[model samples]
Every structure is written in C-alpha cells, then in structure tokens.
Target: MFKIGYRTVKTAVGAAAALFLAQALDLQFYSSAGILVILCVQNTKRKSLKVSLHRLGACLLSIVFSFVVFETIGYHALAIGLLILLFIPTAVMLRMEEGIVTSSVIVMHIYSLKTVTWPIVWNEVCILIIGIGIALLVNLYMPSVERELKRYQQLVEEYFKLLLHEMAVYLRSRESDWDGKEMIEAHELLHQAKALAFQKLENQFTREDDYYYRYFTMRIRQFEILERVMPLVASLSWTYEQSEMVAKFIESVGAAVRPESTGLISLQYLHELREQFRVMPLPTTREEFETRAMLLQLLSEMEQYLIIKSEFKGKHTYIQSV
Candidate 1:
C-alpha cells in the first residue's frame, strides 16, 4: 500500500503556489520562494510559525550583513565567505539557527546581483514573503486529532479494565496460570497516549490546558500505582479471607473504569472495606500475617489509584456518570 501524508501534500501545494505567485509578480530568484515554502512547512502550526519568524529574521539580517560587508570589502567570493563567518555566530546567538540555511539562499541571490540596491533588496523581501506566507497559510489547515485522542482514551481504559480484572482473578483463585503481559501493554499505551495528547495540545493556539493531556497524565499516575500493586499481588503465596474481599472490591473498581467515572462510589466502598478489615480477627500464623499485611498494602495502593481519578474529576466537573 502507498499513501501520501498531510504534511507532504501541504508542502507540495504550498511550494507550487509560492513559485507561481513569485513568477507572476516577476520577483528575481523566484524559485527561491518555493524553497522557502518547503523549509517553512512544519508538523505543527506553532512550529511552522516559529520557523517562519526565524527564517524571516535571518534573511533580513543576512541582507544587512551582505550590504555592509560586500560594499566595504568589495563584491567578491571572499566577501561572501566573510559574510557567512560573521552571520553564523550572530544567528546562533539570536536563536535563529533554524533559519541559517534559508537565509544563505538570500545571501547568494545578493552575491549574484553583485550590487546593493534598493530594488534588489525589495526583490528578496518579496520572495521571503511569498514563500513563508504560503507556508503559513497551508499550515493553518491542521486536521483535528480529537477522534484519535478519543480512540487512545478508550484503549487506555480497556487496558486498565483488563489489568484490574486480572489482578482480581489472581487474588481469588491463587492457582491460575496468567501471564502479566497486559501490564507492559498498559504502560506502553499510556506512553503513546500521553505523546498524542501533547501533540493535540501543540495543535491548539488558545487552549493552553488540554483536557486529554491532563487525562493521560492522571492515567500515567494511576498506572504507576498499578506497577507497585503488581508485585504485591504476585507475592501473595497464599490467599486469605481478606484477599477475597479485596478481589471483590477490585472487580467493582474495574467495572466502573470509564471516562465519566468519578470513582467517588468506589472510594466510599474502600473506606468501608478498610473499616471492615480493622474489625476482622487477627492472623493465626506468621504466613497469614504476612499475607494479610500485603493485602492491606494492596488496598492502600488501590485507594491511591481511585483518589487520582477522583482528583481528575474535580478538575473536569462535566464528567458525570449515567
């Protein structure tokens, strides 16, 4: 299968548009406008705009250096080299290194003309404007990633459900043969989801606080808690009565995992479970004591997980259960 990406399409169209417009306007070194378009088009709008500004600034600076150095040192090959030697450090110091390559083209155009005239300067300016302007226009058509973000959200929730349900199963039977591959899957899923969420954030101009990004951050925190809980669950050599109780609670929590879940109900249930454990009979043997102690720690970790989700709900008040 073969496919063309959105950025590729934008670059091709933008470059063609710049070249046609520059030729129509009769600008010298008109092809340079197309090169600028190719260089300016970026993955994100913010990045494209940033790079455009850098290129524009660097080109203007190069024109100034070329006028001064070429006029003073004579319009020769060595003058061009000398201009670059000075321009590189100044561009780096101004944080416009991204524009260095694009600006070099402008320098070459001035060198070919072998003169520092107002018309030549204006010609290069028009070229920069046409190329960078077309790029900015093309970049403004960023496709929405809301659907993809939602898909990742559903995937992360599914992974959480599977992990929690399996942990419950382990606590109940203690004799099952279950490989913990879902843990690794869930970790990787969260990593990818977070990256996508951040990309979504970058795509926006005014919305500084992206909901999905924060959502993934909360999930990552809960996943960390799960990582800690996994060892405790696996270390249970013998299941006690307390283990069954915790298993049932985990099942309930897993059942409630969703985007709209506040985890308030589950948090209240956990509080009651802790109280119930406090009134239970003391462990009869050393092994029972250790197992019961691990169960208590597991309960604490689950509480942290639910608490994280509840905190997320506080920030997003529209998330309500049906």
Candidate 2:
C-alpha cells in the first residue's frame, strides 16, 4: 500500500486561509462554520459538493432555530440545556448529523460567552471552516480521488466484519449487545457510503452503459438489504445447530488434546460428518452421530460465512434486500 505523506499540510493550509477570512468578515460561529463545513466535505467531485452544500444549509437553519429559541425564551442554564436536548431530536429528524454536531457546538460557544465577542465567534467559525476546507482540498490533491473512491469497497467489507463481530456479541447476549453502538455506527457508514455511491454513479454514469457503473448501483441496493437485516439478527446468539455442536466439539477436542481416550472414527470422517450435519437439525445428544453432523454443518456455514465476509466479496454481499 502506498503511504500518504504531508497530506495534512495541505488541509492545514486550507483551514488557516479560510479561518482568517471568516474572522475578517465578523461572521457568527454558524456562518463561519457553514463556510468551513462546505470545504471539509469529502469531495466525490460533484456529488460531494452537494453533500457539503446540503450540510451547510442544514447547519445554518439549525443555528437560526437555536438562536431564535434562546432569544425568545432567554438563555437560562435550564433553557440552554433544554435547547441542546431539544436540538438532538431535531437534528436526527432532519437527517443532519453534521448539522447537529455543528449546531450544538455553536450553542456551546454562545452560552459560554459572557459577552458575544464578534471576534471570538468569527475566529471559531473560521477555524472550523478552515479545517474542513483544508481536509477537502487535501483529500482532492494527494490521495488520488480514485483511491479514495475505492473506499466504497472497504465499506462493504467492514459491514461484513462488523456483522460477524456483532453476531458473536449477540450470541453471548439474551436480548441485544449493549455495547453495540460502535458496530451500529459502522453499519450506518455502510448505508451512507451506499447513498453517496448511488449519487456518484448517477452523476458519473448518467448514460447507464458502463458495466462497473451498473454493478456499483446493484452493490448499493445489496448493501442496504444486508445492513438492515444483519443488525436484527446480531442478537440471535448461537443458532440451534451451533448450540448443539458446542457440546460434541468439546469432547472431541478434549480427546484430541489428551490421546488417552479413543479418538474413534477417522479424521476425514469427522470432517465429512461435520459438514453434512451442520444444518440438517439440532441433535438431541452430542454423542449421537446424527446430531453431531447437524451441529457441524451449521457451524461450518457460520465459519465459512465469516471467512468470506472478511473480504466483503461474496454471494451474501450481492444479495438484494430481503
């Protein structure tokens, strides 16, 4: 893999330049942030431009709403706290993550100010703008947009890996994995990426004649289905078959480790038997041959699915939303 060097320098430069202008204009933190935010947006050429613009608009609206609320109700500690709390649902309802983050930060700056220092407001806004602009510009220059775009594939792979880990967590939990927030976020990224990818494909391949272009569209839909279903099943814990195998595999593994006991049946038979029975049905007894096979068959599917998903390329990945 090619190492990226000095990409930060470009981003830093962009941020610095933008921040200075925002301060000079004496713009409120919201307006300044809006400009910088527009710059920070990950540029997928035209598609990224839209996202950045949309986020800027959303953030601006949120800031206005918060400002009006505070002005009308007075920014008491309780009021400010309530504003922030109320803003949370508003942000989600708006489908505006960046807006929420920016709006909340802006409210903080305003509430923190004993006096609304124009200079401080402008500086803060400029800094945010500059940071984003620098990052976006730097992203465009050194990373090679092609390499960055290949990240769509990484999203696919991540979804699968997270699915496996999430499943493992769920298997250990009765209801749901309490610590699954990060995994859920990772899965969300997959959907966001898919949405962005769809927009990019539409813009770049408007003609619909390109093969890879068409496949990319298909990939997004497939990813949507998997993301929705994987989380639902994450907490199912061990399937019926895997639970059955847990007991049998324990004894076999035990006998293998100690050689004092009969390792009855050939190793090849054990392999064939496990695969054949992994999915048939849960066995009543781990010692019973029929039951052992069913457990092995299911575990084998789980193991195989995990292995294939590590790379994020498989029939499962391409599956349409169920």
Candidate 3:
C-alpha cells in the first residue's frame, strides 16, 4: 500500500549502495541507475510485483519488442513514426499493459539511441535488482506500516465517500430502488469495500509508517460482521422487474397501520425488512418502529459486533434516518 515513489528517501540509501557496487564492478552505472529507478519507483513489495517484473522482463526481453518494431519499421521510417501504434498490440499480446508502456519507452529510446543487447541488458538488470533489494531491505528493516495504515484509512474514507455517493439512488427513489446499473456499480463498490475490509481485519502491519494500518486492521471484526450482513441486504434488493409485484404490494399498504406492510416511510418497514433477512435473521419480536430503528442503528453506528456495549456503541452511532 506504500507508494514506492514516496519511499524514495529510504530507497535512496539502497540506490547509493547499488551505485557503489555498479562503480566497483566497472559496469554501466547510468543504465544500472535507470533500472534501479524503475525497480524502486514503480513497484510495491508484492502487490504490483508482476508489473515490476514485467517491466524488468520487458527491459530484459526488449530486444524482442524493439527488434520487432525496428526490424519491421526501422527501414520504413514509417515504423519510427508509427512506433507506438506498432508496439502496443504486441505488448497486449505479451499481456503487458505497463510492460508495453515501458517497452514502448525502451523502443523509442532504442530507435533514437540505437542501443540494445546483453552486454548492457544484464548489467541493467543487476542494477535494477540491487536497487529494488535496497528498497525491500529498507522496508523490511524499518517498514512504513504507519504509512500503509494511513493508506488504509484513506481507502476507507474513499469507500465511505463512494458509499455515500452510491446512496443517491436509494435516497432519490420514491417508487423503486437501485437498478441494475446502480446495483452493478454498488456491487463493484461493495467489492472494493470488502477488500478494504480485509485491511481492517489483518494485523501484521506496524511502525510509525504503519500506525494507521495497525489501527485500521485492529477493528477488522466489525467490518467482517458488516460483510456478513451485506449479502442479506443485497438479497432484499430484487431485480427491478422481478420484485415489481412485491414492491407495489408493499407500497400500497399504510405501512404504519398495516401488519403485513412496513410503511414505505416507516422505520417499521425497515425493521420488518431487516427481520426477514435470511443471511442473519434479526430477533423476532412484536414488529415496532423502535425495533426497526434499533436494527438499522446497530448496523449503521457500530464498528464491531463483538460486544453490544451500548445502544450507541456499534452500528447505532452512524445510523442515519431514512
């Protein structure tokens, strides 16, 4: 979660060490330096390892990307002009999106600089590994967990902002609820929220840089509970057409006075809807408006479901009125 770029200061220590070796080895230091830059700046520990590897591999195998481009286009003069056009599809074929970017850059530079071969390529790779090793070592020795957690918090905030944004349909609709597009978008957001929730559940992250990570993950059980409840909430949402009869049937009743109907505007409706949820059934009781509010409050305000400490402790705190 740490920006490999932001770790430049920490990574610099590694760079210096790599430079010392590159110079001692009498290798092409500049080429090594560029490789180090890519390894250090463009990758995280393991998340985007593939992208970084692809970049390195692309650079390693760039003769292929470049050779194809130059051999195919070098004589035409049209090849240099349509360089990107020619290389991109090939990059895709290689399953390298960022690799293509790196490859294209390498291709253009190769065309302009006319340089490529193992004499320098292997040295570049070594330099890159050394630079990345520095960063990985720096991080391993003194991880930026606080920074990672801050990223987690930032992502959580983003999730909420997205959740709030997602609420436009639920808030605006009077006759219906979220449609397929909205639901699909909601599902995507939910997936993001779910992934973000894992950050909260995890506990390995630590350090000044990872303080937020520790905190964010500490309360993971709460989010886990929420995840358990989400599928049920989603089940409440039927297809626009599929649930049309159910929607209208519920709509016609005076939700407050009717036993079968929770008034469209009534908290009683929310309570009944929640009570009937199949995922985690709510306590059966004399269906009341207060009970509905309580259920919603539990989910809305509470962060963790471990203990029902107080009425306001959990989902109750953040529950908003319908």
Which candidate number maximizes lDDT? 1
lDDT of 3 by residue, 164-258 (tens): 33332232232234343533443454445445444333323422233232333433443455445434334342233213322332232212221
Candidate 1 similarity to native, TM-score: 0.92
lDDT of 1 at 226: 92
Q: In model 3, where do residues sit more than 4 Å from their true spots?
A: 1-6, 29-35, 38-44, 72-77, 81-83, 93-95, 112-120, 131-135, 142-322
lDDT of 1 by residue, 1-322 (tens): 8999999999999999999999999988899999999999998888899999999999999999999999999888899889999999999999999999988988888888889899999999999999999999999998888899889999999999988898999999986576888888888889998998887777778554578988999999999999999888988999788989999999999999998889999999999999999999998999999998999899889999999999884335633421
Note each model's CA RMSD in angstroms: 2.7, 14.6, 14.2
Tell me each candidate's TM-score: 0.92, 0.39, 0.42
Report the Cα lDDT for residue 151, model 3. 53
Residue lDDT tens for model 2, 1-322: 9665443455456555665666566655534543453445453434444455545555556556556666677767876777867777776777766556656666666766634445654555455555455445544543333444457555545554454444444433435535656555655665665565454454442433232333344444544544454444442433454543343443343233211212233243346555655456555654545434434443444333323223333233334422
Ranking by TM-score: 1, 3, 2
Query: Which segments of candidate 2 are over 4 A away from where they belong?
Result: 5-10, 24-39, 113-210, 215-322
Task: For model 3, give the 10-residue run with minimal summed lDDT.
Answer: 254-263
